[model samples]
Target: MAAGAPRIFVSHLSGVAVFDPAGDQVGRVRDLVVMLRMGQRPPRLLGLVVELATRRRIFLPMTRVTAIQSGQVITTGVLNVRRFEQRPTERLVFGELLDRRVTLTETGEEVTVLDLSVHQLPARREWEIDRVFVRKGRKGSAFRRAKGEALTVEWTAVTGFSLEEQGQGAESLLATFEQLRPADLANVLHHLSPKRRAEVAAALDDDRLADVLEELPEDDQIEILGKLKQERAADVLEAMDPDDAADLLGELPTDEQERLLSLMQPGDAADMRRLMSYEDRTAGGLMTTEPIVLRPDATVADALARVRNPDLSPALAAQVYVCRPPDETPTGKYLGTVHFQRLLREPPPTLVSSIVDSDLQPLDPDADLPAIAGFFATYDMVAAPVVDEAGSLLGAVTVDDVLDHMLPEDWRETEFHLDEEEVATDGS
Candidate 1:
């Protein structure tokens, strides 16, 4: 690293605010573009891919950059508003270089690259790769011993890496994604090429993949699902919320949907079938079949135990439904619900039925989106039980599902670009 040279890890530069010389906000750094060259030289920083307030991606050439600081980047006031399109020779540091595998020249050992450090070269206005941070040892293997702490090697000391190769880069990518929230992971997945996106999705566990799939746009969800094997796809669907699974299935061709559903477990398939039978905008379509349910005679302790499940969504865990025998949903008679707050206040031995909120009538499975929304708003509840005309507990509609239906059809495709101050203040 050069003395007095401002150095930043590639990961930190992502989402950093970009401003013009006048101190006016421009956009945020979405990615760093670089061009690979022959020989032992590190790739030179080409420019930046900036995402503006309009969600349009534009390029900022390195020549325009005046300063690179901790949370913000300064550029010459002049900027081309033209949307950025990748050229054949250009690659993204954040998108393509990070999380790749490279060989350490000293040890000839393969390590997954975690991040790259870049700095401006002396006597020149250009920035070049400075150091590479890499993690060694087999990924996801508990028995594998660490090869010591991550090594920060000079870029010149690494070799044998290329993003063009399939399966070589995914291990490191998924390792980093394991720490990201599903929404954030989905955003990164969305920006990747279809091939890379599928590769990353294939490496994720069923549960993690399900969560990311739910957060993605419908087209992306379908594309990833298509890439998965029928059996694996079924497993992923089974892991997702029944409502989300049904929605995704409904978007597929009827024959393809049937084929995938047939591969799912009978119980999960049945739940998906029931949810898929309703209109996309109806309560039944927006409900999850796995909400915590308890027998009328069950004690508060039992209800508390069920709500404590780590897999349960916060809204679903906020309350437990009290129902009559044949406890599996659809067959169970809807008695009432026990709010978690009530359970917390009551003695452990108290029967859940005794404290059930009978005044809060359950919504009919066929209830429209507006009606379902009103029910949640009126009761000030994050979730409400859905019942058939026979008063059988079918599922529970969560506020998130209801809101998804209420929002614009293309809401998932919408990009939310945080401003400079917001990114600086955000602790997460």
Candidate 2:
């Protein structure tokens, strides 16, 4: 749902059909995953549990959900088919919340929860439980309860569902720090006790855990990856950026690396193998295999739409590569690039090929860190493409990855301390 969308009552979403961007049916909504906060602060809507055609259930993060309209859930078409596993801090709206008994703040009368309404906050993507539909009647099952005074009340008007202050565990901790950036969260993990860090890591969803793992120190990344079950570890690895996954896998013993690589999708495994074959400090090792790739005939509008994908990092989204046939990396012919700024200036219908900047020479896959750094400095580029001798567009290296290799080993290991005042101010 977008900003200013209507509040959707949970009762309507149950068993709703879910479709992909292409309008192909992917699954049906089974349940919603929410993170309940301390007090009656309104639980954040995490995502939904979608049951696929294969009778397998998957966790579809709200970030991937593009629309919830006409009793159908439309996704961005980028889905992780892994089974949904409820986290320690997560609550199932249908299974656990409905039919529950609670008191109204205004009348002090007990009411049974018939349903809950959720809405995306205006100007933000975060969705939260907003209101409660309850009945002021007896304590029987909500469906069978004799209809009495039924009304919708503000989420704060009800009590009993929110987490309490005392004896809080990982769930509460996750809810409290929910708004932290991946880097900030990784820093938090770095400072936590091993047990606590493992608990927190386990509680995070695959996509989220993959992101946090990317930002963490190498040792911390390995430790967290090691703690997860082998199957889940493979899933997390597949979810990660190809270069980062390769880097992590390269750190393991040959046997361990092969085991994880074997479990990953063939294409992903191939990318990892290709990356691992390169010297760690070279362009091939540093570049991400999955930059936005489009054909010469693609329009500026098409490029812009690709850039808008939430999954792409800012660096990766800065520009798009226009190639010949075979749009994927190792594409047909390495055509020039079209910077995002160029796309914005051109009319929507303008072909990307016309605005392609061929002036900047591409990087060789074997280009060393210093050489790649020189190219970035000379061209003032945030990212640059790498092409093979066959003129195939291999991948692109972003400045952040360049810095990761160039900077001192301890650069990301800063001791992040939140003073009492800072903690109170931001509720850290």
Candidate 3:
């Protein structure tokens, strides 16, 4: 289980407290971050910590690991301690580690840690320090010198890890589903065949797939939906907002659309059909089924109570629409929307009408999306209510929901600037 010269292998040393050649306490073992696509190369060393008092952590390259001891980890040089706070881009690691429990290097053995109850570790996954260290100023380079200490032992050498051994909060990638960045997930999904795409989607839990689907483009969405089984596709579409669901379905051919609709739950199928009835570019098509509706006579207390409903979207909605009595127009006649934040800042039992924005900017059912998007910009509104000629409230559309169409899928990947230059460079 050892590699050749220029690399030293040690035993039973995962999460071992790493020290410099001078034996200065540096940090603890984070994880073995390896490029699996790179084959059987020695994995890189990633040390974990946030700050000195905050429990600072740093990454040491595979080259920096000098030797692994029976119970101690030794490195070739001191690590440059960087506070996690100073690295926004690095926040991704912390969020990944949040709620993830790791086995501590204790007495040359590993044990399940119920909780990471440590103060320095943030409660989100982005806080986890799963990093790969390259020689300073040589990011993405295949070969680089190790930091201070050149060798360290594998934690598995000293003691065996139990399948029952749980990480405090982090779920194993294999046991659950792969937790990939949105862009990375999109890349994989884009390249997968129809059968494999459905397999991948089915394997993942609904929550994870919902998030990944939200980040994909309309074309990709159509491809993925086509691959998915009717039942599974219906489930995924049901989880999406009506506007998103409508847009995605509109991309499909007539036969495929009817088939997919046939597979959906009765209520969801009805909702989608209703949304699809309108012109593709209209406000009706863009309106999301997600809206905050309240009866006009309901007190501020009642409105706040409705807001507390777990099912409410936008945990913080700018306005709550006042509806007519359930018997008259259950969909509710468009009265006005009250700003929830205003009520919270100034508690009041006053009638909703007293605080409601009666002069609300509204969208006609047939208004084009670009026109609707413009309404968002002009009014600086997070969402605008859509109505028919009779002023009957249909649904509301939020800025984030509409902007999903405007933003480009590849916008994020451009930051790495990985093109013919880097790929060619790395391939060599």
> Model 1 over residues 1-428: C-alpha lDDT tens digits?
23367777888988999998888898999999875644456767878999999999988877678788758899977666657767545678878887677788988888888889888777555677878999886432457554645879888788964333233356546544445788878877777777778777876656678999998889999999999878778878977988999999999999999999888877788888988999878888888888887898899999998887556789999999988887888857888989999999999999998999998888988899889988888889999999999889998999988877778867755644223332211111
Q: Model-by-model lDDT, in order?
A: 0.80, 0.87, 0.54
Q: Write the per-residue lDDT of candidate 2 for residues 169-258, one digit (tens) a residue.
A: 777677777778988887778777788888888988777889989988899999999999877898899889999988999998899888
- Name the candidate that leads on lDDT: 2
Q: Top model by TM-score, which number? A: 2
lDDT of 3 by residue, 1-428 (tens): 12221222221233567777887766676433321112122222223331233455544443345555555566757443422221111222233422222333334322322111111122211111122211212122238532322122332322222223343112222122244554456555545555545555555543356656766666777777766666667667876767778778888888888887887766677888889998866788778755777777777887777666443456236677787754122265788888778668655577786787878668888888789888988987888888777767788878776775565656544532223321111101
Residue 324 lDDT in candidate 1? 88
The order by descending TM-score is 2, 1, 3
Candidate 1 segments exceeding 4 Å error: 1-168, 413-428
TM-score of each: 0.60, 0.90, 0.53
